[model samples]
Target: MYWEDFLHVTAAAVENTVSSKRVDQFKEALGFHGIPAGHVPPTFVRTFSFGDIKGLTWPDAGMIHAEQEYDYYRPLVPEETLFCSQRIDKVVRKTGRSGEMAFIYLTQTGKDSAEQTVFISRRVLVWKAAGQRSEGVPE
Candidate 1:
């Protein structure tokens, strides 16, 4: 029942404020102790990320984070508020060593109050076919 209806699952704008505390925490998590908190870490927006795309079927088990890529127009700064949104970009089906599986690509974009793009994050999630085993794993 994987219809193209999922293509319409774009979300409404989600907003977040980049606070000083958030910057510090994100930096600390990455083990950057003395970096200026003025510029946030490249992946800091993940702290306020959302993945709720309508009609998307998330696997309860055996789902893997296949890949992630980020494009930064500029570094996010503390005290800057950003409006963000997420959508499902595409879905692909393929048969590999693990059997038939699906790859779902999702992307999130963040913009400043002035409507300038700050960054974009693209992530891929893999849903493996039932009963499939990864290579080198015992059946």
Candidate 2:
């Protein structure tokens, strides 16, 4: 299968409920004494972002997370339910020191119960085909 086949593909929407305990655990793990009122940690959305990559088959042996960006429309509140979905936005191929690599761009979005967009997370993942030499590895 070609990379083009994955472009624009969307995963099924999933619902996530922000639990106060989970938030507290996250805060504690990160050494945050407290957060601003009415807002969960921005990185908390990572709990839902993985749902975006489900059901996609990659031709590569593994992938590296190259970049991540998040656009927040509003503060995410603890105890709020969010509906999240992910889509493959674009795919680009390039020759790198490791050999040929594929850059997969994906967007994951979260919406509130009221259907307003809460956040959009964009990610870039780098992948090398099976058997491709990695950087600095002797052939």
Candidate 3:
């Protein structure tokens, strides 16, 4: 997995976007996890990402509670709700127990109606061995 230092992906805000299809999928997942329906908030989708990194570039660990929040802009809803995802933007080296590991992340943003700023999102994951951090290796 360490060799997977770089990656690029493309995705979109289709008609079934976070507000629709994803909401349904996440609700289903919650049900499978023994959680009641509606227990999972729409924001929980933020938890469903590649964010396993910690203490280094792990965004949540680096800044203000690793939080993401936004309000619905009914007026800004696009004529075509389908959005797109782009490539993995960055990856960085980190210390690990077994040796070194890479932290990989990607970005996805969407714009509508010439809004000054659309949606900017990032997903990240760690490439360290199970005990890599315990072994104290630097990548």
Candidate 4:
């Protein structure tokens, strides 16, 4: 569909819990010591953020992650439960040598049991027009 139609749309909230084991494993994998500043492991951002968008229909042509950023409002503790939701902030279309492309801007936010925001992750996804080929991008 049209990019404009998806703007401002929000997905359902999903609940997740921080696992100490996973956090420790992530830190060990990256050679980091104890959770610094009480922040959740970086990996948690991606692992827990996508649940809200699972019901959305994505283009079959595939997509590329163009950019991503995270904003932390407060430190998270192990075993803390969070309710996360995703929203489509904006969608823009442009033409390039490859073909028409859509830039989808999304924000995923997490809130703690007390409903205080813990973190927000923003991402930009590039979806190429169907049947178009780009160098380094498999058709």
Candidate 5:
């Protein structure tokens, strides 16, 4: 996708409160044996999920999680109501031996009740044959 188009592709803001009990359950489900540390796991952001943007939908099957990175400015504590804002950061198209693919880079920022950024997550989603456009085709 063009840079201009990518700039406009983004998900609406999503918000949720961080529940301590949910964190405990998540740790147990993953076989993490330990007492509560009060600091949420980097992946805890997954507990608050959101769907695709109106016109940007991932394939129901065959989509791949290409990469992920998380930067924590401060620890996320339990019982704190947090807000998650998501957006499409970048888009790149490449062709490999397998086939054509597009890498959709997405970012989610977790903020405290005060609207301070606590953490930022960058993830790339790879979709096969999703970026190709035939001649005379219009997006």
Candidate 6:
């Protein structure tokens, strides 16, 4: 249901980190004001790095049903650094109700170009099975 990298990418590369103009484009896309007066929205940041992805599939299909939870290293995160993240790691399988599930965890670390960790992000992915056919809590 979620891409693990989202956690990492979200925390790492926010709108300001990307571009203010792009942020507006992102806001338009997300139905937001693109204003920085408030907290930086994670969803917009994720979208900036990785375009619109309705779902995850093969090649990146490893993250199906993830249980892992990630957090930004608060101490390192407040610095505000550039971020880059990828699929990183994953675990895939089939479940009784969900059919196929993979748990993928992504790690992202931001640096100040001096190669120091300015921020860190970890994310989990819960890949929904193909042919699920319906949108309800799998029984």
Q: Give lDDT tens digits, candidate 4, residues 38-134.
A: 5666556676754544335665556889999989987678888898998879877788898878888889888888999999999998888634554
**In model 4, which range of ten residues has the least summed lDDT?**
130-139
Per-residue lDDT of candidate 3, residues 1-139 (tens digit):
2223334434333322334445557667766465444343434435333322222232222112222344433322212342433455566666756565566565645445343334555656565542233322222
Off by over 4 Å in 6: 1-17, 37-40, 48-83, 87-94, 128-139
Least accurate 10 contiguous residues by lDDT in model 2: 130-139
What is the TM-score of candidate 3? 0.41
Q: Which ranking of candidates, highest lDDT first?
A: 2, 1, 4, 5, 6, 3
TM per prediction: 0.79, 0.82, 0.41, 0.79, 0.81, 0.46
Residues 17-105 of candidate 6: C-alpha lDDT, one tens digit per residue: 54555555666777776455434445443543522222433344323434333344433222244544344454434465746664555
Runs in model 2 with CA error above 4 Å?
A: 36-38, 49-55, 58-61, 130-139
What lDDT is reached at residue 137 by model 5?
A: 18
Residue lDDT tens for model 2, 25-99: 888899888675455899888876436444455443468889999999988888989999888798888887878
lDDT of 6 at 78: 23
Task: For residue 1, give model 3's deviation from the true position in Å.
Answer: 13
TM-score for candidate 4: 0.79
lDDT of 6: 0.44
Model 5 ranges with Cα > 4 A deviation: 1-8, 50-52, 131-139
Better of 4 and 5 by lDDT: 4
lDDT tens digits, residues 16-117, model 5? 777888988888887778756686777888888643455444455656898899999988788888777777777787888988676778888777778798
How many residue pairs clash per model? 0, 0, 14, 0, 0, 7
Q: Write the per-residue lDDT of candidate 1 for residues 4-85, one digit (tens) a residue.
A: 3465477777888899987887788789987864877777888875546654555557778899999999878788889888
How far in Å is the alpha carbon of 8 misplaced in model 5? Answer: 4.5
RMSD of each: 5.7, 5.1, 9.6, 4.7, 3.9, 8.9
Clashes of 4: 0
Candidate 6 at 135: error in angstroms? 26
TM-score of 6: 0.46
